[model samples]
Target: MPIHERSLIRPENLVTHENLVIDGVDVSGHWSTFITSRTVTDYNEAMEEEISALPGGEHINRCWQCGSCTNACTVNAINPEFNPRYWIYLIRLGMEEELLRDKEILWQCVSCNKCTYACPRDVVPEAVMKATAHWMELKGHTPKSPSTHFDESFTGSVIATGKIEEGQVMRSFFKKTGQPLNQPWLIALVRGLVLKFPITLLMRLGLSALIRPRTSGWGRTQAALNDYVSEVEARNSKALGLDGKGKH
Candidate 1:
């Protein structure tokens, strides 16, 4: 079966016998594979509400299993396991355990907005993925993902200077993620760019590195943004039933 069409039944719940005979009927090998029945009694009833409390999760309740989000998802094209539709269903049903099966890759959404555009109900699967990822980190289900670190680094630079400095953002992300600056692909990319357009690339890089980009007279804007961010954080924390003082 295609990954998207695969049954939700857990593999461990499947029972198979090499040979079996019951009442003049022969059931062996392939025919013997049967799924064992099970009950799910540990649903987290607050799952939907808690997820909805997060910034990107607001529209999650509007999903209707239309599959448009998953169909339009760029990440899902590469990895069918990253099905936004399925995750939405699981979330709405409070199947927290089932949802966690794909937790590690939840932050892989590229925010292409294709899912958002294709959704008839404005489900905004891209935002939903972001919210679910944030929810995972906030609830301590997983450590902060590298993507989250990159986002923080990028956003911090933007908020601090009212503009993004690519070199700074890259360095900060690498430092926060404990990654080496000399990765093979990165080296190749830089080499290719320099070889193709040495003078232009060199001047641009030199100038950008020498003088960091910043918005003029951005202090007031930064202060206002900081205040708005703090207010939003407090509201998110309260919605999740957490102390407003918790670290974001």
Candidate 2:
């Protein structure tokens, strides 16, 4: 559905005449306000296809503008400008410029999954938001978000060793995001783990943190995973026309 919400209109796009007369009647101020009309000369016809090519955006075409996703969105409830329905509409229509206008708020999605559950067509608006934010970063329209940094750190650990050490991932994430390791929550978590975790388990965790052990016979699997990840990255980069500028 076309967004006709007056609040969604940009203030600069709304023109108002302070003093105006039409047909022997006076219409001024808000009464004389009108939205500006402009032609979109640069529609990226491949925009939808590019976004769909990314993870979590595969079902973007299934969206029928039902508005259910927006209605159920947690962030939308707080910030109406964070409208998934509107962004999806713009993407489908290849309105790249219009979509970029809201690029900053795209990553604010909390991934509550309410929109996905409410979506009758399973559009998975939350995933679309993630994919869109990732698309922005890959295209260099925006910097990598803190969440993306965490994701990369976590994924890198797994791809390298095929083992997930919670503490290591946390430390890597904090380092990538320039956060201190002395976070209160992290300290509390460590304390709790030390207090309650089994003696053997705690020892293993500590040893692993120091040794950073790799899964046995993981070399072949690690190579395979690296190749798969490289393939996916290359494909996504080509789709977005990153021209070799895409971040891994």
Candidate 3:
């Protein structure tokens, strides 16, 4: 099919003549802007298969360009550049270079489930976004995004203790993201919580920092989960043509 979205075409691939005459008619500036035709020879034919191997990407091949995902996307409302439908089309076609154009904002998915609910084919576009972001990080196409860092921190805490303390998760996320924990909004939130529930707040903070709450007799369960996660990682890496060490 034709390019799914005009935004997907890079600016460099579009040519605009400052001055032009077409059949004695002036068609300069914006009127003269036209997409430059070029052959794509660097297709990563396995790109779609690799992404499909990741969690949430399994249903990517089911998408049928209904545009429901883009229409229902929360991020798309704020930034039209974040088009899930277009990205899915690119992935299905193995247009790796075109998909990389929006790599920086790919991880901004809010996971509101709007796209998932609206999808007619059970495409689960939300999961595809996560899988795409993970693929980018794994392939070294992009660094670990802040959202990825936050997810890893939260997941790590849960895997370690079979539970997560909100305070600890937040602290770990901020630290891993290299963000200051003393922001004004955070301070205000803490102040309000302390003012209303001083003892509760203190207990939570103390327990999270010092006591470290954990599930009782979780050793065996934790070990099992660790092994399962490691197995999944290895399988995903193999599917993506990566070495075991590159598993995320």
Candidate 4:
């Protein structure tokens, strides 16, 4: 364990990511860094342009590293790399590629809305974080995070079912992740409860269903979104004299 507050620090050091403190105060030596400023400048510039282009992105540049959003972040409490403050700093500097390559860390955000709840400027930092991660993914960063994968699967699962079917989603997710199915006891318990308990009990099951993301008004909402996208794509394609798909 490193001593508190006095760990010899520099921009190039490769410090252990888990040792979070030196002298009981969080210090940034390794996990808190990125590629050199000279190499990152272009990326930073593009990042700023892309982010500020978003509806709420103008506020992204308004951050002064107050750390309020970081402090309020739930992910930061668990993993140090998931720092909203640092990433926002990266954004302010316009380090687009750095942020893009950092898709692994960036996608760790849970989007719990806590950062937004804590932002004094009402910057909606949580939404910005998610948007940045998604943008990075679209730009070829390729999301490698489990949360991102599960999030997509969960969304797809819910859309397929009126509500999330935990057993179904977990089976799919586990198969995808190469995790050996090991929830035998839980599965048995579920089966037992379903067999012994009333069907009404299953209908009233609130929490388990939440794990699979069963949302109300989703079918109509999804159809509306599909229609909206097709119309926009048709208009856009017409303007470009291309097919209704937004591809070249």
Off by over 4 Å in 1: 1-8, 18-30, 194-206
> Which one wins by lDDT: 2 or 4?
2
Score residue 246 of candidate 2 by CA lDDT: 37
Q: Which stretches of candidate 2 lie over 4 Å from their true place?
A: 1-5, 19-31, 180-206, 243-248
| lDDT by residue (tens digit), candidate 2, 1-248 | 23367776777887878888899888777756777897889999998998998989999999999999999989999998999999999999999899998877889998889999999998889999988999988877888888888889989999899888887997788788898868799899878877887797778877987898679889999999999998888888887887566364
lDDT string for model 1 (138-204, tens) is 8878999999999999989999998998888988999899998688998999889989999998887
TM-score against native, each model = 0.87, 0.79, 0.86, 0.59
Alpha-carbon lDDT of model 4 = 0.65
lDDT for model 2: 0.87
Model 1, position 124: C-alpha lDDT score = 83
Report the candidate with higher lDDT, 2 versus 3.
3
Worst 10 residues of 4 by lDDT: 32-41
Q: Candidate 2 has which clashing residue pairs, if any?
A: none
lDDT of 3 by residue, 30-97 (tens): 75577888999888899999999999999999999999999999999999999999999999998999
Runs off by more than 4 Å, candidate 3: 1-35, 244-248
